[model samples]
Target: MPTVLDRLNLALHYAMETDERVTMLGEDILDPYGGAFKVTRGLSTKFPKRVLTTPISEAAIVGVANGMALRGLRPVVEIMFGDFVTLIADQLVNHSSKFRWMYNDQVRVPVVVRTPMGGRRGYGPTHSQSLEKLFLGVPGLKVVAPNALGDPAELLAAAIADDDPVLFVEHKLLYARPLLEPGKGDLIDFQVEQTGGAYPAFTLRPADSARLTIACYGYNFELARAAALDLLMEHEIFVEIVLFSQLSPFDLAPLFSSLVRTRKLLTVEEGTLSLGWGAEVAARAVERMDGLRVRRVAALDLPVANAKSLEDAILPSVQDIVNAALSLVS
Candidate 1:
């Protein structure tokens, strides 16, 4: 029963052990401290030569990783905090992502940038944000966020092995949570199934037909799932939940199939509201399904406050999903 952080560390360990080309670099990722979240714990102890501790510069770290990737190496970088991902935008979006296509498929950049996102422990505005949306539409970059319902280790391995550059996002809150093992056993009242893909999308289905389908990613699913279960028990309102691991190359098949059963959908995310993940999902869904009712629950367009109470009020919550589901269904 390993935590999400444990699984991620295992994946890194396996990748480095099996693939001589794989290397990891970040700040404060050495012995004792390991990493800010300890995902790199024992990695340096195992592979001291490959595990590098650099200065506190996101741009420099990504630049180094990008170069290493181009010259026959697979580098997995840690941003320390997800917010600093912006500093690496130029090297990542322009250089690392574009090289393969720009070279007319002559080469591949197999680099994975891992970072923790979302707000729950009050890291404040800059430190606690879901900025994946900013990198979503980039031509050659792939955005991935693993959830509690699938094998994050497998997905991380896939990302490391792939020929393209991937931005691996981890919800900070998810590090300590245990992931539900796929196909081992079903939940008490819900049937959980995952789509077979490099990065899987898990669907949690209730016994009866659903009035609404709630689609979310990362830590937001935790809140959404609780709200869905509450709606079913307290109000007898069945809501199907679809949780996705890959965000950029978002697979709408699972969601579309759910919509076929439940005509309505409520997209929830921890990211800010206007022009965000929810908006894109809702728009793409409408293009495929006719008369498909949709609603989005997301954080307000304001910086996450440092205070716990203020942060909780600003970010999306279980109550918000419950209210949104009720409104969409009725």
Candidate 2:
């Protein structure tokens, strides 16, 4: 299996080849260097007319993509860092995201804003923060993320083709890891099943599982699985892991079923602890389900530090997941 970055690059190639309307615009996305992370390598070379290298302004990049999307072009824009998403919030939240509804469904913004998020490479606070929390509840905006459970390329392809505005999040740390397929690699000991949707959610169940389910997405998912392995091997604590790729239009279907069996949920995320994705999940579960206990593990509310040690402390770790799981079960 190819790495997440490989799959994403392949998705771009496939989308551009099949759909004439598909286009990409961003800074440094051209051939050779390929957009910082190289997710767009060889694309500009293939479709020189459509793949545009924009200026450094993130706001302008998204604004142009929004205009293209409204004009019947499916434009996938890239932000160099996820932290810079703030600069384009107005363009995204007020204009592009609301265009369809505000115009009474006459014009559609089929724009996919792809950016690398999460911290690990010590890129400092400006480039290393996970800011998807800011867009979770935005009307008409779909938030999608990819974990290693399945082919991320498929998810990216789906996002690019969707009619509404989508925020596609690529965790920086997950770029180089191989996609975790069912019955292979990181998921070998577990039974992985993906739900049916444009962005599928994966549920991993061990043959012998405890009454606790750990739910996470993106890069923290890698941490959760590792924590689960150690919890099972060293502490005899088994847990079911549910991975979600879709954040907005929040679908709890994949998780509700697991909660039915386990009746215990531990939501883990790289975002901060206050008013985050995990909070929404926990709130909805308590409202819809009966006799469920939920706990959340996320980064500290403070800013992400550039120092590796402080950064690690601010961000949730494998030990955090392990301890949270034990607390949930015990």
Candidate 3:
């Protein structure tokens, strides 16, 4: 079984081999260094010409990639960390994302910006942050994040092939987890199914009844799933977990259908409590479902501290999800 990072490497390799116009640029991504997380490991060695090693400038990387896209090339730019994506906001919001619309569909900007997010590794304030919600409503830009239960490699390939500017968010913790293969021993009695659309999504339901539904993405799903399983064993709370592959243009059909079975909903995310992605799900549920109870669990609105205790205190934990689920169900 390959780790999620291994699958990402395979996806990048497949994109490079299939598309001659696809190029990758990032800092310290050369053969020896690979990358900060080594997600791009062996790529530069494999495709010497298309793999570009850049300086420590996120803005510059986006600018160069935007130019490359304008000149008819699919450029994948990796910002070493998710925190630095703010530095490239001007380029993404003002130029690249607007190219297709501002020009009356005369041109297309097929650029993918990849970065790692979340804070389980004690990366502290700046290094670990789930800032995808910051770019959620940005027009002409698509935001996608892979959870523990889906094929990130296939989603990455889809993002690379799409004709829009995509913010590909990878949770730091999910990179090392095994890919969720179908019909695996652990999923014997569970029904695992995937949804097909611009954004691929997966749902896991137990053989019996589902008393509640949990919605999440990125590495946060690890905590969410653990809580769900614990609830099942301790309290007889059957849960259906829905993982989103695309954040913006969020595909909510799976969530809506799951809600039909279980009127209670709990949304978990690594971002801060206010104005987060979980809030969006809660609001949508209020609008679409009558008499639906929705609760959200997210990190506190503060910088992630370096110490393990402080990080745990600020971020959402499995206990938080368990308590929230119990409350929602009750």
User: For model 2, where is the 10-residue window of minimal lDDT?
Assistant: 179-188
Model 3 ranges with Cα > 4 A deviation: none
Error of 2 at 148 (Å): 1.3
- Which portions of model 1 miss their true places by more than 4 Å? 182-186
Cα lDDT, all candidates: 0.90, 0.91, 0.89
lDDT of 3 by residue, 182-286 (tens): 667455556887888857777889888898889998887788778977898899888998888899875688999999999988999999989999888888987
The lowest-lDDT stretch of 10 consecutive residues in candidate 3 is: 180-189
State residue 148's C-alpha deviation in candidate 3, in Å.
2.9
TM-score against truth, every candidate: 0.97, 0.98, 0.97
Number of the predicted model whose lDDT against the real structure is largest: 2
lDDT of 1 at 4: 90
List, residue by residue over 150-213, the lDDT tens digit for candidate 1.
Answer: 8789989999998899999999999998987644433566788778978888888888988999
